[model samples]
Target: MPIALLLAVPLTRAPYILSFSFLLLIYLTLAESYDVLSGYSGYMNLGHVCFFAIGGYTLAVIVTKFSSFPLALAFLLSPLSATIFALFISYPLFRLRGAYFAIASLALGILLYYIFVNPSFDWLAGGMRGLMINTSENRSIISYYLAVSIAIIAILTHYSIPKTKLGLALLAIKDNEDVAKTFGIAPYRAKTQALVISASIAGFAGGVYVYGIGYVNPLTVLNTEILLTPVVMTLIGGTGIYSGPLTGAVLLMIIQEVLWVKITHFHLFIYGLILVLVGLFMPGGLLRQTQIQKIITRLKG
Candidate 1:
């Protein structure tokens, strides 16, 4: 799939499609990472994008301050930095259940955005002025490759979860944490690990994104769209499996790109319409369409 995407980049030779694919890849990673927690573990993290910003800002700081660092090291450090932050916050955040946890995460993200945007914090981050990272002539190509790599990693992580004890514990907890605890599955441990993994992937994606954009501001890196779009994509795709988020991201990106070219203000309306229709009839997502299931069954048969 990655190879096909890479090959298609040049074969089509259309600059806009390449841009669309870049957006698609970024959202695909975000959606899949969100699914690791919200979909499989049934924990809605409304502020999943915080980790993305963490990674982005971390990369920006590193690359900006220490210009001699290897690009690969900067990329690796971004997600690692986010994962470290995730570990610190997971314990306290996981204590709350349902809406409380969701709201807390949302608040945390907003708080970070405002704090970083403050001029007083310019020493830590760039505040309102933001930071611009050095870029190369082939920066776009590099960003695309990095985005593709992270998206693949996110998908692999999703696929791998169901195969491990941690994944089983997550699934068990998703169904019922109390029951999972009774089964000797450590819910706290599993939840923390899930959060860490989810955050790390998001951070990695953010680092790539900052490199792509050539700048990182609080608003640009930590936007509400980043926080919400993954939720929408995960819900639309089918939460139970890996392909669901990918499907959701691809479809939505295409729709947004195609429509925005014709009707500049149609994306949100279309999202609302899709959500409404999904809520009315296809809550299980496109992967769960009756025909899709039947075809899968027959193919396996």
Candidate 2:
């Protein structure tokens, strides 16, 4: 698939297809990261995009202010910065549960959005004007590889977790926090670690995205689509399965492309419809179907 994508880049006259492919890769990483916390550990983090925003902003600030800085250094520090922010907030945020936690995450995202856009922070965050990355011939290709690496990491982490002790503890916590606690599992530790891991992956992807796109504004970098799309893709493909996010990202992205070609302005409307239908007819998600599950099992075996 990756080879096909690379080949398609120069073969096709339309350059936007490559753009869409990059987005698909980004979504795959984001979806997998969300599944780690919200799917496996069962924490709905609406503010997850804040980490993505932070990573992109981190890299953007460095590149914009210091043109001579090494790109590798910027990328490294971006996700690291996100991890620090995640650790600082994880303990207090994890204390909330269910709807309250969801609300808190939403509030946190909004707060960060305003912080970046506010006039007071213009010197630091670039305010509404935001940051512009220098464009280059290899930028898209570089972005593609960076996103691919992160996507691989996200999926592999998701796949390996279910086979480990931490995975079992996370599943137990997801199924019943109190019961997991009774079994001597530290719920706070497990959840916080998962959140940090999720945030870190998302941050890395965001950095890749900004690099590819060649610009970063608060509205674009901190878009809520980052939050909703991952959750929707994860749920549609079936949470708790390692490949669910990958399938969901592929299926939904293709659907979105089709919609964009056909309806254009109404693509978002159709996206919402697809999400509703998935919720109504297939609560467990498309991949959880018996036939599909069997095929996946055989392939894995």
Candidate 3:
């Protein structure tokens, strides 16, 4: 039903509607991607946005360098680059556990942000000025559908992971890494697999995002808010379940949109306060709240 509504959104021919829905799908894609590793495996990756940034910049560079290259082919390279980077970094990054891993990931994101914006890389990444691409007349609509496809893929990946060995390994590791290892679960391999999947989805989504906008810049792709939204949405929606990130993405996106439009002056403060309150009172997330659980039970009944 929701999918039907999303499919019909473009028919409205409303610019704001298309734009809003596109942004929502993008967030949903990222949140679900983040949930693949962090929600199931208990690895809080604060630098997950690094993949998104890399994906966007990669596509930007490709199009800039090979203007005649097929855009479809260039888009594919975005996720490939992100996946390669994730595979390369997973070894050392996965070695750290708990907050150490989280902080290191966060630092990694910051480091990449600076690297993309550095003057030395201008020939490739265009430095702080960013890269601009020639967008086609129908790019927005095409990108919107592409974003939808990636979001669907992310949702299916989240739904399907738990039924597989990797899923079991992730859940086991989340419960206790040492115990999981004793049970024959290769923690490093499982975690790496999850990260690689998450990175690829995020990369693809980021590519669609930049392609939609026809621009890529460090501030746009690697901003602090961009880095944090997926984490916040996944946590607030509830982890360890398929609906958690989806719930959080829809709820928070709506609330944030409303706040930004209505309470423009204090929206950020209000947003932060709401998150603080959720943390204090519903640390298990909205899905795990007793009231919500009862509601779900009633619906199922």
Candidate 4:
């Protein structure tokens, strides 16, 4: 509610204020979803954006072809498609641990990119040129609401999952797979569920993003920058708690927006320098600063 109010109030009634809020929500969802699997479960999935792209493309194909379906329905289906894809891939992929798992996901993402770009699949996805979506004039407002709702849902889901029996199982697996197996935790299954849940939310975000942007292509979907953005956000925000990703996303987005306008070409260099300094001085993330840690410690004490 506080976040919503912060988003609602503007220094001036500029449309860009709303747009920034919408983008912030989008990145928040993406970052939080990434945290679920990678941060909490200790499974590093480098292909998180693949699930996101799948969701966006799934909705795009559906809405573009069958204009009769409600946008909400299409949005729902996008995550379902992502879940199905995750289910199929998780079994084989979970066998690989750590770097191997990461590589496999990255490979899968690249493979999917190729598939989407293929001429044969062009009928479904509109090929390498991409599909342009026609949206209502109030698309920005609609997108803002949708993005905020999705961000809330993602945060709730992340918090809820870690408290359930299944979440306990996942935490066990994260701590020690061999020990988790002794307790019948089934690391593979837990990992798969985490992947599916994370991917589904990411895909849902993608669906909303497509509507927000009105167009998508291989360049947008397959870009390394898009894939890394959530990872960076998660790391910067601190990953263990619900607010970490949200903090990271907001901070990073603000920096990106403000710095890019002032120094376009040096933005990436500046971002890199920030990351380096953060790593050296505040390895736990900006949200995990000494002051915040002290407060948390005092509260626990």
Candidate 5:
């Protein structure tokens, strides 16, 4: 029913609604993807958005370099590039754990942001100028549908993971890595798998995002705020649960819209305050609240 409503959203012909829905779905995709790795595996990777930036830039570069290249192929390459990068860095990144791992991951994002924004790389990445695509009039509609499909896929992936062998391995590692290793679970293998999958989904979603906007820039795709959206959303919604990111994305987006319109001057301050409040009062996330849990249980039943 929710998906049906999303499908019907384009029919409303309201640009603002479409735009809002698109951004919501994109963040939803990112949040779910981030949860798959950090939430499940207990690895708090701050650089996950690097995959997203890579994806957007991958398509941007392909289109800009080979103007005649098939857009579909370019779109597909987005996730591939991200997955490859994940595979390349998985081993080294997995070697570190906890705060060390997180800081390293964040450094990766900052490095990429500077690389893309630096004028020295202008010949390839367009530097601070950014890259633009020639999109059709119906580009927004197509992007919306792509985002919806990808978001659904991310949701399903997050849901199915906990039921799979990989999911159990991750849970075990999350609880106690040394004990998981004793049980024949390869920590690196499982974590790498989660990271790759997470990167791929975020990459594809990033592609859809840049395509929809018809342009890409370092700040737009690789900014600190953009990188943190998924983490914040997942934390707000409830990590380690499939429904958490969805709930977070919806609730945060609504709050953001309201704040943007009603309190433009201090919206960021208000937003940060709200996040702090959530952290202090609902540390386990909004969904983990006993009342909310009861509601969910009744609905499930």
Candidate 6:
């Protein structure tokens, strides 16, 4: 990958490469989080951005109010706050199923948006005005490094979880709840673990995002588009494997960069059309098709 980047640098230039790399890191982290709940646990969390927003807001408030703290401490607080928020809601949320769960999550996100917009909480989040980070050219480079590190950490964490008992239990529950219970796997506990971990990763990604963008508004955090990017990336790339999100993010980023410039207003229309076509023909996603064929060949052998 480094060698490929080195060769492409002449054609792409350093700044564009750096910028896309930053976004790629963010996408990779967030996509892994999405897959833990949606792919592994079969829980559709449409409002996953709520956790991300919480992390961004938490970091913004902490860094803005207590600027004296070490940067590392501030970053930790962001995801910690998000994790706490996830834990607080997970019990009640775990009760809902299918479309109900998805709708409830979406509602929670909208509620957070309203709370952020409220005059009473205006001071907390700068209300609609948004929170701004103290910036420097050096800080930007530091943020890019932070994003890359977080992405790598998220990927490692994601893969490691599935090797643990809790991870296996979650997969068991995902396949069949009654069978998992017969084997003594607590379905609710496994689901909550996946949800909390996914939310925390997203929270960390949100922190990196705010640091990079240097601004945060409720609109930025609560936007449906922001929520869908990771989902679409996961589906397009394939969700059942660890590398799927990374592949999807890279592919989507390239397509967006290439076509977005040519069709600014109708870019989403084109994207949607492509998605429809992919769904009709690919079904199991681009990567899954290859995997399915390989499995069939092996079975025949």
Better of 3 and 6 by TM-score: 3
Clashing pairs in 4: none
- The models' CA-based lDDT, in order, is 0.87, 0.85, 0.92, 0.84, 0.93, 0.80
Model 6: pairs clashing at backbone N, Cα or C within 3 Å: none
Clashes of each: 0, 0, 0, 0, 0, 0
lDDT leaderboard ranking: 5, 3, 1, 2, 4, 6
Per-residue alpha-carbon lDDT of model 3 for 1-301, expressed as tens digits? 9888888888999999899999999999999999999989999999999999889988989988899999999999999999999999999999999999999999999999989888999999999989998889998899999988999999999999999999999999999999999989999999999999999999999899999989999999998878888988987899878899999999999999988888749877897898788879876789999999999999999
> Which portions of model 5 miss their true places by more than 4 Å?
none
What is the Å distance of residue 275 in model 4 from its true position?
3.5
Residue runs of model 4 more than 4 Å from their true location after superposition: 3-13, 279-283, 295-301
Error of 1 at 34 (Å): 1.1
Per-candidate TM-scores read: 0.93, 0.91, 0.98, 0.91, 0.97, 0.89
Candidate 3 collision pairs: none
lDDT of candidate 2 at residue 281, scale 0 to 100 = 82
TM-score of 2: 0.91
The digit string of per-residue lDDT tens for model 4 on 245-268 reads 888898999889989888858777
Error of 1 at 296 (Å): 4.0
Stretches of candidate 6 above 4 Å error? Answer: 1-13, 290-301
Q: Please give the lDDT score for candidate 4.
A: 0.84
**In model 1, which regions exceed 4 Å deviation?**
7-13, 298-301
Model 6 TM-score, 2 decimals: 0.89
Indicate the TM-score of model 4.
0.91
- Angstrom error of the Cα, residue 47, model 3: value is 0.7
Local error of candidate 4 at residue 18 (angstroms): 1.4
Measured with C-alpha atoms, the lDDT of residue 227 in candidate 3 is 86
